[model samples]
Target: MMHNFNSDPFYLTRSHEFDWNGNESAGNGIQHVDSADITSLFSMHNGIKASNASGSLQFGGSLGQFEKWDDPIVADHTSNHNEKLVKLAQNREAARKSRMRKKAYVKELEMSQKRLLQLDQALEKARHQAAKQRHSIGRDDAFDRAHARWLGEHERLMDELRSSLLSGEGDDTTVHLLVDAAISHYGDLHGIKSKGAGSDMFHILSGTWTTPAERLLMWLGGFRSSDLLKVVEKQMQNLSLSEEQLVCIFNLQKSCQQAEDALSQGMEALQHSLTLTLSSSSLARPSSGDVVDYASHMATAMSNVHTIQSFLNQADLLRLHTLQQLQRILSPCQAARALLAINDYKARLRALSSLWLARPKE
Candidate 1:
């Protein structure tokens, strides 16, 4: 019968001698294995064992167990993997830094844009102010030029009027009436009226007293008392003086003296006020307020001039009335002498006025 060792438990007992390399014999009728065959068998067993361990540890394993599979090739693969991870981390960091720099640059650009916008606005504002200032200056200059031209024209007209008066081209009576009418028109325009007869006389003297000293000297030269006295004496020889006439002459002299006194006082006051205003340092390049004040002063001076002119007209009327009265009272010879005296006085006055006007203002 054939031996059934596969089924016999005692056949493969632990005490039985066996040789894995087939270099030794078992205590049975087994054939001896060749050394080369034994080598092949051992190689097959190792290959099977390695395959089993690798398969078992495939999904999950400890670091030590994984390291057991380490060889030159495996080590090189790990090194390549680590290098790739390092490069990826470096790339991530570089990207992050780049993003940060980009953000900063964008912010800087935004700030620059805002700054440029502000500068543009500020420049525009400055330009506007400069333009406004230039416009204001232009207007002021134009007004000043116009005012100067008006003043020149006014002075020329005054000179012409003075020349006509000295030339005796017009009758004194007609001139006096015209002056009165002009003064009334002026008063109406300005809404000014005489407060009283005394004030009217005061205004007249004040206006005349303010005239430049040179003009006053020229006016004084016109009145020759010596010629007037000669004419008066001749008239007296022909006609006796009445009580009413003598009283009238005395009253006229008293009025004239009073007018002179008022004139002197008004001049003193006006000069003082003018000196204070003109000498002030602040008036040099007068401001708007200063200009207005100066204009007011000029208006006042002109009003005074008008008042004096009105008074002179009235005085002329009075003189004509007085002459008429004398003619009514005197004989024909006395009336003729009185007329001659009046003519001579008028001629002398005209000559004096001409001489005075010809003299330059000092």
Candidate 2:
């Protein structure tokens, strides 16, 4: 049979020379083939028979011909193949999310490490600062201790100096005499000149007195003079003694009438006394005891000057005389000059002696 069916060109077709049954004969007259028999023959036959019995024939399956198709149908097959592509894309997106999360985790760890490093640096700096502060405190404490020790030593030295000056002991009679002389001069302030540059006995002892005791004694005598003078000035001011009143009070002892005559007589008398005393001392050498007694009397006389009993202190006058007598006896020695310096004894002697020499009336 030869038939043409054309709904789709890809459907099967039958040719005239092809055989339907398993026979060598071709159909002679119009054969009445049942549809069922034809269907059965189509099922049993394969290859050439299957090709001939088909209504319209194609050489291969649609899948086999698909290779020769145009882009549209080819794209349809490619589209079907790409179904798994969506799954691949979803997997790639998941991997990307995982990688991004890993990077973010790594960054966080780096930040944490950096922060730890910063903390360590801060801790080290704080430790160094604390150490420096401790060192500074130690240095300050050391300085304070040294200063305290220095002050203690200074105070000890000053105490020794004060003690040495205060203690009156030693072997220099001439220096002692100088000291007594200084004390006498100071004691005479109220009666004599109230304020003068007034000698510092310490300077005089160091400069003038050869005797050790006398020098030390002289220093002791004047050590408190500057201080005493302050006290006296304060007392006098409190008493409201005017400057003119002070001058008048001082002049009273020198206000005797027949002034020039009295002065001449007095000077002559002082010179005579000096000559007599020197002559006697040269003949009779004095004992050390006599010299010592003379120093004591000189001290006593000086102490009595300008005291409350200045005019009527008979004991003080006797001490003055006794000191003069002893000084005369010791005049042969060089140390005798130290005694004479006391109370201006040498001058008094010279004036008395001169008076005797020039005396017209006995």
Candidate 3:
């Protein structure tokens, strides 16, 4: 009962090479192990040996040979990665469009702000201009009323003078009344002009409220004193004026002319000084806060304007005084005749003005 050993079937086991621990590295294709890792390696090696005992292992001829197998987890991970790339591209495109829309909105907002600012500036300027025009119109209307009142009173006085003259050389009793009434009316008119002088000096001085014909004869809101003297002298020419009366007339005319020359020179000097002050500097451009001293210049200009207004008031006073002196120099009959001539001149000028205003225009 003997058995043959060579005829029995046998299994070949796979083996792995181990490497001992060194300073840094284990060479390729070797299991690297330190003294601490040796215990775990023995258990792992036993598991692999037991698994090999239960199954047959197939090996290719080459050491680098690899088997190709399809796994569900690997295929799913590839599909998910492709989907992520598509999602990332879409997100980038959406972000680009959002940035473009935001930029356009910002640009439009800037343009709208600029337009709104420009509109606001134009509206403010128009409002300012309208306010100034309204003030000018108000001044003109008030002056017009005053003139109407004076004309009505003056017409009554003229009628009285005519009646007295018709009664043969006029009465000495009414002469006092005539002279007093005339001087009082003129003083009232002068006072009205002076009241408006501070705010509307240029308009009052220019006599813009008067009719065009009256404006031609106007000097500081009334007729020039020298011109009045001329009227008086002409009226007295056919009268029996004495030597003393003639001398008084000559002296009055001389003084009025001298006063006018002095005021005129003062006005010219003021205008020259203001012109030089404005023209010599480079402040023509608008001020930027404290960069330019606009307040001081404004004060200086206002002072000059006030001085000019004072001169105009003085001229008005002189004209009133001259009329009073002329009335005093003449007798009642002679003074009444002079008043009549002056009224006639004024009536002729008004008639001329009416015609001029009604003339046709293109």
Pairs that clash in candidate 3? none
Instruction: For candidate 3, write residues 54-94 as lDDT tens digits.
Output: 55322322222223335789989999999999999999999
lDDT of each: 0.48, 0.39, 0.73
Q: Assess candidate 2 and give its lDDT.
A: 0.39
RMSD for all candidates, in order, please.
Answer: 34.8, 37.9, 29.7
lDDT of 2 at 194: 17
Candidate 1 off by > 4 Å: 1-234, 242-282, 288-291, 311-318, 321-333, 345-362
The number of the candidate with the highest lDDT is 3
Ranking, TM-score, top scorer first: 3, 1, 2
Model 2 over residues 151-268: C-alpha lDDT tens digits?
3553443333333334644234544454344334324422221111132222221312112222333321122222222333344443455566456433421232233234335545
Q: Say which candidate scores most in TM-score.
A: 3
**Comparing 1 and 2 by TM-score, which wins?**
1
> TM-score of each candidate?
0.29, 0.19, 0.58
lDDT score, residue 48, model 1? Answer: 56
